[model samples]
Target: MDLEKRPREGSETWVDPRERPAGPAVRREPDAPEGCLAVAIRIPVRIVVLVLVVPVRMLWDALVVAGRFLNDTLLRPLGRALLWLGRAVFVWPFVGLWRYVVVPLGKALGWLGHVLLVVPLVWLYRYVLTPVGHAIAWAARGVGAGAGWIARGVGAALGWVYAWLLTPVGHAVMWVLKGIGAGLAALGIGVWTAVAWLARYLVVVPALWLYTWVLAPLGRAVAWCCKGLVWLLSTIVTGIGTALYWIARILFVLPALALWRWILTPAGRVLAVVGREVWDALGHAWRVAGHISLALGRLLGTLLRWIFVEPVRWVYRSVLTPVGHVVRDAVLRPAAEAARSVRRTTRQALAAARESVRQARADFRRMLFGEPRQPQPVDRREPSGREPRTLGSSTTALTKD
Candidate 1:
């Protein structure tokens, strides 16, 4: 806002909904001041809206609490258990098979193929094929050199024959041909010169004379006649256009403009006033309705707590709690102790069986594969990819992580 629009120091700066804009003709205008119609609309609308919205808001709050409680107490743990079970039953077995069985078998097969096929192929390529290729290349080079020598000798003989014997004969023949060509060329030039002179006099001269004298004057006269016709037609079109423009203005444009300025404009202003009042009333009613709904929601919540929650809480704490404690101490504790004892004895028996099974498996494995090797620690200066960093570790750029 500009300085003129800003409120002055020490002035009451708060806006009043009832306040109208500062202007000379503000009273004459329809949409500025709030009217009796707005008050008539606002009061009933707010009351009706408050009544409708209170029940909805209360139900909405109840549903929100119920949903949160269900998600936390029932749905959340069930989802987690399902996720774990799915991984164990469907996903883990495939992952283990790929990692242990398929990967190792593939590696062994690849190693076997390399040893049996690739190694011999490499040996043949390096030892047998390489020597044979070198021998062929050496023979090819010898052949190429002999052929080149023979070609050079043949070329020298051909050059000598051309220079000593054929050169003189060719020169004599060329000299005779040049004399005959000179005579024919002189004769052709004379014939061509006579034909050109005849064509200039018979065709070109007459055509030029006809164009300069006859065609140019005729074209200019035709052009003048065309220009006169175009000028007369344009003048007639301009006069008709001017007459039509004035006729349309008087018949259509002037009356329509007068109707809008004198009639429709006033009616539209009145409609704007009614519409603005309705809009402002709706806005004020909505805000008032919100406050009323909030108050009603609080009142209903208080009533519900007194009627339902308080009674349930009282029953759980004052009645059910004592009964639960008595049952737990009198009968449940003794039963739990006996069950725990039985579980302990069964666990001991299962542990012994598991020990025997583990020993037997270990003996079988040792007999077949011998004792497992322990990994030796190595000194390193750089960190491994994706491993957590520590005080002793430093990373290198070659690590993708």
Candidate 2:
């Protein structure tokens, strides 16, 4: 309520209505015009141009479509046909050229390909494989040479051992054989000397004594006896000869003459008549001998015919014919058939018998032992340690146990 500074309304305290105070001035926006209405009143040229260009663009599109249709329907098809006709006109000649020239060129190219592939392989064989093969061959040759050297060394060593160790043994053996031979020779000489001396003493002296003392006298006595026997035989032969001559003259000669004169004359007449009768008898005897000879000849001929011809025929017919048949039927054919049967049967029987025996053995073993015997399995695994039994000394002790 202290009115000490009351000021007039229009004065500086009222801050003239048109002028702001000094601290803060009032800001006034400029009055811009309504540009949106003006923009709305202006005509849009893009819309007019769009309206006018649409019909013209449609007419141009129609012309393009008409051109595509004319090409597709007539012009393009005619062009394709002309190109096909041109290809057809040259096709046969092209094919002929390919067959005559190009095909041959292709074949040559294939051959060249093969040559190209093979040439490298051949080069590899020459430069790489050949050298490797030669190296292998050389290695083998070296190994063989080493083996040969070893063999030669072993042979030389063996030869040296034989010369040093065995040669003396062989010489000693030969000397022992020579000594034994000499001893045997000496024994044989002594035996021969003893036998010769014994023979001289036992046989020669006795033979000489007997010859001197007894044999000479016996020889003289035998000679004297032989001379006496010869003299007696000559005297007896002379006496018997003289007595026989006297007897023959006295007794036989006179009697023989008298008897011949008395009896021979009548006997001669009778003998004449008997001789005439016996003339026919001699013929009869000759006829009988001829008949006997004929009978013997016929008998011998019949026997010969029987032995050579008839008996051979009989043997062929009776023995050989039946024997051949019997051999074919009973021996040969039956033996072959029986052998075949026996072989088949033997195989089957052996198989069956083996099976039976095996079963029987299995049954017997099972019955005896209450279980079939099984073979002990062999251990393939490496042994962990040696068993006490495997030790030689321990095994010897175990044997006593």
Candidate 3:
């Protein structure tokens, strides 16, 4: 839908902005016409580039396929295995130690510190120190009030003396000093006026007359002489410049221009056309070579699949698979069952004997100690990864609650 309103159908002056094309309205300049030389150059250059690029494109494609095969078959698996080994060797042990040992120890130390130091400090701050600080603050407030009162009394006395005794004496001194200052300022002003008048007549008047009368006419004459000299020098330089310009044109510039206009320009245009043709041919050849290489690679992959992969796959499916299944059912299953039976029997017998020994020890302990006391359980810490964990599962006691 067009959000902008359309131009009125009757209005010849109005054009709808939405009706205009998305791009700029300006037309593209047409390509210049190619001469016979460029046309002639393009075909041969493309043929040569195509011939040269085909083999290289095929080689590059082969290297790419080989590198991919090697990475998938060998390098990728080796890198994954190394990464797993590094994690197992370097990372997992530290994680286990931190989880199993350090975490527990840290929790125990934190609890001990809280009980031993933090509790006492908190008690002292809440009881003894808080009361002492409050008492001291209260005493300091009282002392401050007394000091403020004393300060106010002293300030009042000082203000009274300043108002009554010092004010009149300062006023008398200021009046006398004002008279003396006025007399001194008048004397200085008269001396300054006399000096200014004498200096004006002695130095300033003479300098003004010299500049206005004698020096002014002399400077005008000098300036006129300088102007004439500059004009003469400029005319001589201009003549030399004109002569040099002609000499340079005859000796170098005209010949250079002639060489450029008659020889180099035409040659450069020809070379430019040839270079453009070569560059275009290279790009075209490269694209064509890419298509050829892709086709060749597909053909080669199809041939390899028929010759190697299909035969091996067929052999594995038709020949080995049935035989392996038969062996697993007939031979391996019975062997595994027998092993499991033996293991179960051994474990059961061992467990029964251990139970007997434990019962005899318990009987002896009861007989000797008259029923041993059971120990109490401590607070359970957070469970580690020894237990199986499921996704989205939490082991925290609060979560269970």
Please give the CA lDDT of all the candidate structures: 0.81, 0.74, 0.87
lDDT of 3 by residue, 282-336 (tens): 7767767888899988998899999999999999999999999999999999999
Question: How do the residues 140-218 of candidate 2 rate in per-residue lDDT, one tens digit apiece?
Answer: 9999999999999999999999999999999999999999999999999999999999999999989999999999889
TM-score of each prediction: 0.65, 0.23, 0.68
Candidate 1: worst-modelled 10 consecutive residues by lDDT = 1-10
Over 4 Å off, model 1 = 1-105, 165-170, 263-280, 341-401
Candidate whose lDDT is highest: 3
- Decoy 2 TM-score against native: 0.23
Lowest summed lDDT across 10 adjacent residues in model 2 is found at: 1-10
Poorly placed runs, candidate 2 (over 4 Å): 1-179, 265-401
RMSD of 3: 14.6
Per-residue lDDT tens digits for candidate 1, residues 1-401, read: 11112244455444434455675423222223456765465556555555555566656667887899999999999999999999999999999999999999999999999999999999999999999999999999999999999999999999999999999999999999999999999999999999999999999999999999999999999999999999999999999999999999999999999999999997897677667655654554555555666687689889999999999999999999999999999989989999999999999999999999999999999999999999987857555667786654444555434
